[model samples]
Target chain A: MAHVISMLPVRNEAARWLRATLEQLSILTDRIVVFDDASADDTADFCKSYPKVRYYRGDIPWFEQNEAELRRHLWELATYENPEWILALDADELFEERATLELPWLLNQEDYDAVAFRIFDFWKGTEQVRIDGAWNPWNRFSPLLVRYDSTLSPDWMAQPIHCGRFPLSYRDRVTFYSHLRVQHFGWARGDEHLKKYLFYRERDLAVYGAVQSHTESVLSSSITLEPWIPMPSPGWFSEKEHR
Target chain B: MKKRIAILTSNHFEPSGARQVYGGAERYGVELTKLLLDMDCDVEWWQVGDNWNKEIIPGVPIRGVPETETPYQTMPHLNQVFFEQAVDADGAIYFVMYLAYPTVFPNSISISHGIYWDHPGMDKFLPSALDRQEWHRRLQLAIGGVRSVVSVDTATINWVRATWPILAQKFSYVPNFVDLNSFYPQNKESRSPHPRLRVVFPRRATTVRGINEAGKTALWLTESHTDLEFHFVGRAHDDNMERTLTTWASSHDRIFYYWLPPHLMAELYRFSDIVWIPTKSSEGTSLSCLEAMASGCAVITTAVGGLCDLIQDGYSGLLIEPTARALADATKRLASDPQLRERLGTHAREVAETFSLDRWHSRWSEVITRVF
Candidate 1:
């Protein structure tokens, strides 16, 4: 069996839904690697309580200044385990229940090296996902699970923000977009939305001269939300294994 | 001694840096450079860039000139700059015809890819009647100034002949070519049967290439037929356009979007069963269409620009107007009828043989012998 490892980055996520996130990840991943970005709270203690998780803390905060560096550090720590596949996720994101059943067959396939899934951003409540403007992550595919190749050197983007979790070099490899969904609960509450908006205004204003439209759209009153619906299982999942 | 030649164009690499551009024009430049090298000529390419120099291909140095913009068109200024810079070369080749406008050098040739002003939206660029007339006057001067004008299709030659009868003598109709060995039908015995019929649109994601129309048609066809798959295999001009196409493809299970370089395109064409070339305007003998035809894929193209010269309605391939409805109807017809696809694909391969790279090299050599 191939080992599936999950690498997560955290910052003051103990007060948030970190426990629920870890519980969900425990069902799908063989081991969970958590990197705390010098959180002020006891997020390190909370994460270390889980038996599957291996915790590490940064000496100094680096998420706001440079995201690519933080992700590279986490990647180096995750690769030390010699995992077959690495799933990069955040502290607030969780794969739906169906992923536990569908991912085994996907990982066993030899054709594709990376798997991209549709991400849903839950807004205001946990039952609904945002669909208006750029909040609609279901419109695009995001590659979360990648087969770790030791021979190729991974190159990270130099940007301070919006730098992807996986190396940009994985784009040239064959990627399969699976019909799986990852639910994000970062914006599920009202207070956290305000804090996120303020954080962007502080960090992103220096990088981008003007406020990004997607950032502004998050606070718009005329937002649209759709109920969360799990995708049906693929036909191959039910077929009998010949071997 | 080898003949020294200078080639001038607007862009060989992306303006941002030294990245090689991927499109029909860039492919033509590569093929032309190879032909020139085979004829024992020393060639160099010059384009608008940030004064950086690099090699486009081995032994072919691509020099960049700092770009300048004017209130009017910037190409004429770039042309003068290139002419002044390459004054000592034996001859020059204007990769784009309009770049030679209002300027001329001795022993020079110009190439017209196709008519670019055929689209309805061109009125916004040249708004008045006098503006349109002045545009024609500039084109006339450009054609008269060059020693020879090599056009990729007869549509451009016919348009020039109707506009200025005297300049018709200078025009040479040399349509684009494809390598038959690289792009050919996959053998029937080796072919693996799949459930879904793969249809491909192998052009850039641009308005003039009719990506919007093809995208709309793809949505309709995928919704109507469950056993059909649509693949878009080309790059977009910008990140936003690429994102839009990616989003659309992601929303549908049977649709896919990706890009490949020129060498890998042959394999993709062979994998595809049907090819769509729904060009709205501003097209030459599109290299994608030629490659797809050579790969023995049943092509459905609009009768726009040089596409009219390549595909015959109901014979070589299905020809129709540039519209989403027309594209959808043709795709639906080709999807249900496999025999029609095989017959059209067979005829398309036969037609493609007439436009092989060997013939193109010979024709270009004849023209080069006369001018250089």
Candidate 2:
């Protein structure tokens, strides 16, 4: 059994994003599998730059089968790696520098089979910019981090778009931490981001045969812990300025 | 002679800024769907999701492509199966451009919710680096197959006709009309206490809507005139607007900025003496202007785009050029003249009767019937 680790799935993305993902994960895991899902641009070539990166052409024959194939690919990776744990992410998702450095120690623990990390989704380049306030707390996505051999069952027809489906028995073995967060870099500048979004949105509609509303997908589903609370920019605004 | 009328939308009650899915569009759509149901016409509002509860609107049937939560990136994939579900509608209006929506259907009519000029230098003011040119190209290409173009204002119709002359032949003009009964003078809280000569600005806090210029004009009005109160409405939660207004408000006691619920907005108009709009960008006839006018408020709007059609300079209300000095002077003059305010307010309210809800419903119903 190979102790293989997979780096989620990706499509057309800039080389810089790929660089950030690789650099963040270099110290934590040795086995790196990169799934290339028919990128129109040079995303596949960019992934090949890293020596340890294992690239696979997405098995979906047409755009309609993209989602099924993507979900199945993750299952396949889990079965093949059979490692202690499996880390899943999109191309835009990045492991923060602090979390990346500390991941090895966290993974070595025996109590938690799947580890959950706090994710601070900064508006991509807002970290260096002074124009906007601190990152928005309302914009966060959470998914399960499980052991490689875990049997995961997903209910694809429900909420939490990507992570709507999870194994019922694996609930008690998972743990979430606040110190480490997945830095999702999906929202960048320009039409390139919109192009990717539009492409994925269209692909989703084609496969599913309808528009899945965000309100139902996020707010009304079983996955929602509570009603969406309007949280102010936690770190950006002072208590006085919050009102 | 029952007909199928479909209103294409991404979803209802979402935060999208499109007129159909947001604000008055949803109300208008609901009203239109109800009207069609009464007429025994088959009406369906289609989108990608299943958030729309069947019992939300009684009697009117709502259909969706599917309740899909797939992680596919493109929009066409979501509705590839649902596009087969389109009934032969007498008329169909694509409210906002979802990828491949217009192209998916066979024979139908599309109404222009708004036009994107794709102004080459629009990015100079807009913060987003998204290619306006490409957005415009795709928008124009998508609507190319529509049977005819229906624009709410002459400016949008003229711009599209002139920019793409080939498509001009199919242009139809239908001014935006408001429900007079829903927005007319109500026995709401008695008009705002005119403790001081009240000046209200109800536009978005963006450069596109000329909020900066309006702010500068407000500053000039307050500095030059002592007995005036300035009120700014709409999206006060915006960070940039908050920052700018906070600094300005500290020095000026009379200037107030805050957002009010839409229902309460009618009360703001009922009490205000004058409504000032100093917008620099494109505006499909503003519903706010019509509402203010119907509630008997003198409107001081710039002579740009649809505002020109609404305000007849010195007659209905002042039509000043889009400038800080010009708007400031106009406000000052309106502040001094109580008689002019009363006259303009009365005329403004009277003229608004033409665009009342009954009139608009009749006009829209006529379109649906013709197509059927």
- TM-score each candidate: 0.65, 0.51
The 10-residue segment with the lowest total lDDT in model 2 chain B? B13-22
Model 1, first chain, TM-score of 0.92
Alpha-carbon error at B104 in model 1, in Å? 1.6
lDDT of 1 by residue, A57-153 (tens): 9879999889999998899899998999999989889887756665665676454577777688998888888877777764566889998987767
- Report lDDT per candidate: 0.82, 0.56
TM-score of chain B of each: 0.97, 0.74
Which ranges of candidate 2 are over 4 A from the true structure? A1-243, B1-5, B9-91, B96-104, B118-144, B163-166, B182-193, B236-252
lDDT of 1 by residue, B1-372 (tens): 998899998887766432445689888898898889888889988998888776666458887787666223337767888888888779899998877876877898899888887977778767888877877777778788889999999999988788788899999989999999989987654555557888999998888988999989988888889988888878777646765666667678888776655655776777688999999999989999999999999999988999988999888899988899999999999998989999999999999999999998888888888898
TM-score for chain A, candidates 1 onward in order: 0.92, 0.65
Q: In lDDT terms, which candidate is top?
A: 1
Q: Output the lDDT of residue B285, model 2.
A: 66
lDDT of 2: 0.56
